[model samples]
Target: MHDFDFVRPQTVSDAVRALATPDAQALSGGQTLLPAMKVRLAAPAVLVSLMHIPDMVFVRADGDVLRVGGATTHAQVAREAAGAYPALASLAARIGDPAVRSRGTIGGSLANNDPSACYPAGVLASNATIVTDRREIGADDFFQGMFTTALEEGEIVVEVRFPIPDAARYEKFIQPASRFPLTAAFVARHSGGARVAITGASESGVFRWHEAEVALTSDFAVQALDGLAVDADGMIADLHGSSAYRAHLAGVMTRRAVAAIV
Candidate 1:
């Protein structure tokens, strides 16, 4: 890794202050950032670690929402959020192997906004609120596209508030080697309606399968999705899977998620 100064801040405000400096980047978990640094894909002059910030690591359940601090580790979410939000917890449990899970933070995941990452699907499906140091951004507005978000420079994700769904499930078709999804679906049924979010398949990044959501909202069952199809026009196509294959998987996974929840 290139030479850089590292600072661990004890509070969100402090971390924000540190990140305000030119060429300084916020560090959380280091799962994505450190690897990039080592490969010289990213080279920030200063690494401002958010892990030590007290307000950025915890899990709590409010009336109908599960609140997770940004710096909270996947393992922590897996254990702490199980009772309050089992489906989301399950998603966290399946993110990566033990080592990656232990180190990766939800904030980092969402901030990086990798198209294949799992949290975007869950957060979007749940219509969660992303609380940043600057303001609260709705999940719908938070994720702009692949590896992109609404966060401005130096803004820190303080917390994420996920509304506890009546029933929800995340189904992933893993690539096995990387453990990232070849295609995945997160289905959440609320009192008002249902939401279906697809990840790991779209070229534009994670997106809602609105047709499936409409059908599922009308009838929350596997049979509700009988004729629904995921369009392949904008799906990711590569060696692992074709756009058509991933599109097909998106439908299958969404059906599986509905089946589990129903």
Candidate 2:
């Protein structure tokens, strides 16, 4: 890793200020960033640590929303959020291994927006809100693409608000080595409608499976998806699997999620 100045800020405002410096990057759990730095894939001049900010590391229920701090660790969520959102808790429990779970933060996960990440599917399917230092962004508007987000420079994610769904489940075909999703699906049933989000398969990044959502919303059954087919043209194709195979897996996972929920 390259030499860098480190600043641990006590407040969100101070953290923002520290990150305003040139080549300064916000450090959450350092799960992804540290690995990248070691490989020389990333080299920042300054590392602004948010670990000291108390308010940015919590899990609470607010009316209909399950609010999770940006700096909240995956392990924290897995342990603390089960009553309010079991599906989310289950997803958090399955992320990477115990060490990665203890260190990886939701803010880092969403900010990094890894195409194969599990969080984006849950966030999108739940129609959560990404709260930042500057403003709140709807999940639909938050994720732009793989490794991209709507957050501007120096804007730090404070917390995320997820509307508690009536029923929800996330299913993933794990890429064994990395523990990342080979093809994952999160199905959520809300008062408004049913929402389905697929991750780790699309070339455009995590995306809503509209046809599955439409079918599941009406019937809420595994058999509801029998005829629905996922288009393979936009799926990610590589050594792991072909685009067609991933697309097939996307459909299968969606069925599994719906089955688990209903």
Q: Candidate 2 lDDT (Cα, whole model)?
A: 0.94
Give one digit per residue, the lDDT tens place, for model 2 in 1-262. Answer: 9999999999999999999999999999999999999999999999999888999999998888999999999999999999999999999999999999999999999999999999999999999999999999999999898899999998999999999999999998999999999999999999988999999999889999999888878888999888898999989999999999999999999988888887
Report residue 127 deviation for candidate 1 (angstroms): 0.4
Residue 98, candidate 2: alpha-carbon lDDT: 98
Question: Deviation in angstroms for 131 in model 1?
Answer: 0.1
For candidate 1, the per-residue lDDT at 50 reads 91
In model 1, pairs of residues that clash are none
Cα lDDT, model 1, residue 112: 95
> How many residue pairs clash in each candidate at the backbone level?
0, 0
Model 2, residue 167: displacement in angstroms?
A: 0.6
Model 2 scores a TM of: 0.98
Candidate 1 local lDDT, 70-178, one digit each (tens) = 9999999999999999999999999988899998999999999999999999999999999999899999998898899999999999999999999999999998998
Q: TM-score of predicted model 1?
A: 0.99
Tell me how far the alpha carbon of residue 221 in candidate 1 is from the true structure, in angstroms, after superposition: 1.4
Off by over 4 Å in 1: none
